[model samples]
Target: MPLDRRQFFQASAALGASFALPAPLLAAEKGKERRIDLVSSAFTVALDPSGASRSAVWGFNEQLPGPTLRFRRGERVHLAVKNELPQETAVHWHGLRVPNAMDGVPGVTQHPIATGGRFDYRFELRDSGTFWYHPHQASFEQVPRGLYGALIVEEEKPPSVDRDEVWVLSDMKLDNQRQPVEDFGRILDIANDGRIGNQILVNGLVAGSQRTLTIRSGERLRLRLINAASARFFRLAIDGHEARIIAFDGQGVTPHPLPAGGLALGPGMRVDLIIDCMGSPGQSFPLRDLGRPPATPTVLGALTYSSQPALRSKPLASAVTLAPNRIAEPDLAKASDHYIIFQGGMRGSPVIGLVDGKPSRIQEIMAKQGLAWTMNYNAQHEHALMHEPLLHLRTGEHVMLHMINETDFLHPMHLHGHFFRVLAVDGKPTPHREWRDTVIMGPRQSIDVAFVADNPGEWMYHCHILDHAAGGMMGTIVVE
Candidate 1:
């Protein structure tokens, strides 16, 4: 339900009221479990709205992007995932604080849901923010084949807006017949910038100016943008509207206008934006992907105003700040400092990288082992039996991890089970110091992030570029 002015204020006030319900009664009501059956099977989808051709896809619940799972904060969710496809798969809740066993990396945390098998994932919603879920098993192939969806945890006191929307931004590589190309896990793609899809998609359909978001003038919208692409990055900008970012990767942050270069959403990242429809009636504003060539920016969609009169004479004056999640801040003075150097890609020095148990150079491994990238001078395959974790810390240790990217390719590194405060970018202090679960690291750049490792378990830390993880940019952090 949309939070109107009255409900918004009441909810905000309820945050301070402790005299409402008894602890046992409140726990019983809030802990009421909701279960849903999620099935992954092979289906055909016409990604092009014209229905030129249908692409064979493997998605959850017969949908390209799967069903959007909604839950209130503190609610218990039981996801009974049934695997109907021929291959094994497992769903990973991208940004939620699930138990170590429920983290969903096949073979690492729990066994993959085998073909024709079912896995029950039960967890409580500990955070209120926009999140998503996708297959962690062979993600390079599964994700592009259309197996991802939004997971929204409604805030106790959300912003008052005309409407709240979620846009799952993704891409797909297709042939002339609109069939998905089976050339996944290629060495060339893994070695360089991960494989990029030709067709950009917004919620399953092809994204273009035809994909429109209708609104009335002088209305405010809470737009949650999620990037579920394998490797694509969206540097987005609206033609005539001002978009202020309210949160990053679901965590609340100080509301602010878009940075000078617009919003850069890397793969597996999410951003919440507050867009005020100040346009005139019948006007349309194109949402362009500026990351492409400046000569011709790709219009992902358009924001068009209805023919009706303005909703109000002026924009909504309600505060856009979101309720922050429960995350422990890192004390820099006592936090242990660690460094991870990212190496190997298409172009780099003739460095030796560990492949399996043997050391191999970049050139030889791609042809023989289908590996391309390395972390800390070692390359690891997903769910590999011999792989070792990158970092190990006590259950509540404060860690200041400095990630040094040496390659010439971009990597959106994602850390599971925890949101870290981005302390610095390229050795310089960040202004907002926002918290994010997934962060983009530029070529030859260094990023310093600090967080308290309070979530005890073995967590995967890998590049969000699915191919890169299959290549070698995959590792785990152990908090015991």
Candidate 2:
């Protein structure tokens, strides 16, 4: 069946009478710090229409995609994470520029919280935009096993709209019994396109017309899209509607229309869209991901209008721009330039690299070390307790990172603790030159990004593809 047309993909009632997403974990009060108790453990849930099938998942507060933690900008938050899983884990606040100790890369920032242990993450929210949290220890396995959540910090006076929604988009490789397939971090998968998921999810439910966004005609919505998948890039389009992008990776940007083809959202990224629903009452439009093959999109969900009369005859005539965060702009004239050459992959050029600091071929590194990727010709494996960061800069230095991708695979590169201006891709200046904590690097492409090293710490810089991270495409950056 062709999903692009979506004639058979109406938002069904099979999921439930009202398939509502889990509400925000808790709200905040003015002049007061918000605190929450988050527990990570394995639980069972029915993932399909059949009540007989249940999936064992690891989630926070017992909710897959965890709880939506919403807070006001500048509010202090105390999140106490208790790990009930057998293995150790730590929570990383994705895209948040917090103090280094709270960044949450187990070996880099803090020690992994052992089983039956609790770690208190106390930080003050300095910026407001779409962000997320997930386990940093063995993330290649933990994230895909249902351990991630949205963390939203609202601006003091955000644009007025009918409603706000958060969608955590992810995918899982499920087995016959609807359980997660356990194959993780295989060299073959790590060196290729990473381990692609078999089942797509929106807000923890199997997507494809099961979930819906209900709206009244002429209503406006602020949709926050988070890609929590281990490795899935979404090229999305809204049928019969216009959605202007207001933010990327939690940083405000000039409202822009859909790119020439579609909006490409890679793993570990977020997009804030301002969608004015001008559809007629009782009509529905499909939100599709065209990245998958066969010229057919996978229906992520639909925007359905209710039977009530239209809220207005025309779309709201108001600005939908977001206020910018206080990120220090890079002084390019004084910024120091650095290079990071990425090499090795299943289909990449044959190159000689290091294994345990000894010279070796890429093939030998994969066959003997269970690793398949390299950053800067160094064999700094992810399983190590300590390592030399790929780049080091003095605190408060402005630096430009020129990342070269020598492999034949798309890598969504994610940098923790700081947002960089994407100056260019493939040697061409970006129109917006948007600030992002994560950006996609095309095969054999070059990207230039610049950021101010204002936050001092050892930050994890790695591929958002979890398997690739496990297979040694991961490293750390230090500023001191």
Candidate 3:
């Protein structure tokens, strides 16, 4: 269904609330012990190490990027979300298999959790891996303003590592006063990157050294990297260590053992990695970025080293065992190609953002009750007409996408409903091939991602920049 404007607002009004139950009680185990409470409210906090001024916005229980809710596979998980915001908010469980009503999508899967009201979300933990939760109402505004958290469903067994850390990355816009900047009207500029923020924060703090963990020279570390940003796409790297990507978007994959590459992460995307420390004892290994200029690359966190011990260590058990059900890959002749050009902004200055070829406006959005802003040139959200014919395939046919980034800025193109393989980047197959949900495309660069459209729905493909997406940089597909 297209985005329903009035319905969204109506749902928001109905679900807004304040206050939360106790945390320990929320997570207290019953029978076998399994429950959690995730708090949602506005906050005044800092993301950079300089510790900037506090701001106002929605957060989980007054905390930015709320609590990390962990559970074991096959267990019954209960979550009580207490909304403390002045406006309505609901938590959407991204990439989880549960009853539709527990999905936390306001006006869609379930009703919003009204202000001063509470909702009990109970579901069977059918799958285990990295997942996240965030508001779905006014998604452009709510999510960007800091309403997200990590939801890790641990497997009966887990991956081997000396330590496991969950990292959530986000961006923010603040005034000279260091307060969160709020201008709902300006956030919908079809002529510019919608909601592009000036400040970057990791785990709810700005780029600054916070905690230091001790690691040995040969110790294996696991990093669960999650992109919960409302708009920004991040390219992440760590200095002085070799890391291997073992999972994505919450599911384990065929382990492709390779050196760590720059992670192109988008909103709602997750990458699980195993790293072997090569630095000497007492040295610090910083998780740095080889990010391009204008997009600063800095240390998200650091790992301090301890003297190596003589005793051999045992690896943590694998989180998952069964292989994922993968669809066949498409060959060149058996696949189809499509072209999407992000057209907007003045030619020389690449700051202007556009979907397909048109600019979006609120008046335009309000005019269509069921229409949403499409990111590509297509007008109908997810139903844009292509310059070429739609790619047709059998029920289980393999499909390849040749996605080109025509603009100067970066775009983390995400495909909902299915994971695809990075077949080629700029005309070559990915060196160490792996399945990915979001592929980052820099200006003038192109990438080929293939997947079998097995699980059918109105899948979306667009830039992960929430601002760009809200301004009309999105489209959808339907499989019959």
Candidate 4:
């Protein structure tokens, strides 16, 4: 059964309402600094055009899709979050390499901010790219209720384009009356695919299905695509056009043409594309999800050309290369190898796992308000967010992690505070080794990633599947 609003609040409130300590006292550093005041509250949104079919959702500053926060590459951000919701909430700056204190995981990094409490987050932006922010406490509920926003870190020397736009993609489960359904924390959903929504949204509008961008022929565009959905994986393609994938997960990569099969964006992932309008005037093209059923290819958006002659008969001739961030390459020859295995999630099989250094079973965990998932044999209970580190490493150590998935589902694993190079999958070396903050692990798959632990702090490594992570598939890495 779905949890009622009061029950959801009770569960979120049980996360504890302790205040976080003040950010480190550092001199107001020089750089582009800005103060952003964000308030979390409930708002009514019109999912349909009639305005009668509205959904009550939680949002930042009473606006769905919150606000687009823009910053420069080396700016200092001082963000103050005022919680107006009925329960506690904290924001995690997804994909940003902020200090450990500003990572925003309740109990693990900081305490949850209570109702009507205000928390200040101060951090310096190191790398400029596409990132996002959302509540970390009870995210399985808060995020799905519409509490996420886009964060853009402008490049020092950005590429030239007619327009630079951000497309925040999301999904929501709705009832017959167009109201958001309340089936959060269902056991079956937690064990299987985590909360796949029925309706797809782009920038908080159902109109995304038919939204059109008018452009002149031969004009160049820069599109920043963010997958903010809780669990949905989007396989997208732009019909009648070719897009060059320049960046992934906020990290710049060697520019390459997107595959004909399209790009796959899992939860917590981002992709940057540079595309040129090639279609003739008065012609229209669609940006669609190819993974959906043939009868219904989810049309994310459209591109319509104006009645103007082409600037040049052919596409843009200039070759483009993005500036790479300053990240140390892993020394694979001297890398220390480690393994983290995923287990459980069987229908009839018993979930035998460990919770907080104690032996526990699936029934026991469920009875205590927990889900059935684990990483390295450790399952975190609902009330206890902080757990011992899975492994401790010294700074500058290059290590290889073999993430083995034994379950029957896909898990997009995300590592905070650092990006890792994907070396191999299923023991097969990759042709183009790429760096990513989040890697999708398929069923019964084994992926090997190498990274240098240069960041000095306790960072989180967990499944991007919010429900699974909340259930127990989360751990911390301590680099000293």
Count of residue pairs whose backbone atoms collide, per candidate: 0, 0, 34, 0
After superposing candidate 1, which stretches have Cα over 4 Å from the reference? Answer: 1-31, 292-295, 356-358
lDDT of 3: 0.62
* Pairs with steric clashes in candidate 4: none
* Stretches of candidate 2 exceeding 4 Å from the true structure: 1-18, 27-31, 49-51, 292-295
List TM-scores for all candidates, in order. Answer: 0.92, 0.95, 0.73, 0.89
Give one digit per residue, the lDDT tens place, for model 3 in 1-480: 122435533443333221111121134567764766666777665444354456676787556667667777788877778877787777777766566567665544456777877888888866777888887666677887888888887766685566677777777788888677776425334334456567666666665444455677666777788888776666777776656677877666666443454766766688887876666777886776545557656676677778776123543344423245333565657666655555433222323322334554433452442233333434333223342222334456667677766556566776655567877878977764666667777666888877776654344455666555554555555544
What is the C-alpha lDDT profile of model 1 across 64-102, one tens digit per residue?
677677778888978879999889999999999899889
| Best of the candidates, lDDT | 2
Clashing residue pairs in candidate 1 are none
Candidate 2 lDDT by residue in tens digits, 63-168: 7677788888999988889999989999999999899999888877888999999999989999999999999899998999999999999999999899899989
Q: Which residue pairs show backbone clashes in model 2? A: none
List the RMSD of every prediction in angstroms. 8.0, 6.3, 8.3, 7.9
The better-scoring model by lDDT among 1 and 3 is 1
TM-score of 3: 0.73
**Model 4 lDDT tens row, 402-474:** 9998787788999989989988999999766888899999888999999999888888888888888877887
In model 2, which range of ten residues has the least summed lDDT? 1-10
Candidate 4 positional error at 227, Å:
0.7
Q: Return the top candidate by TM-score.
A: 2
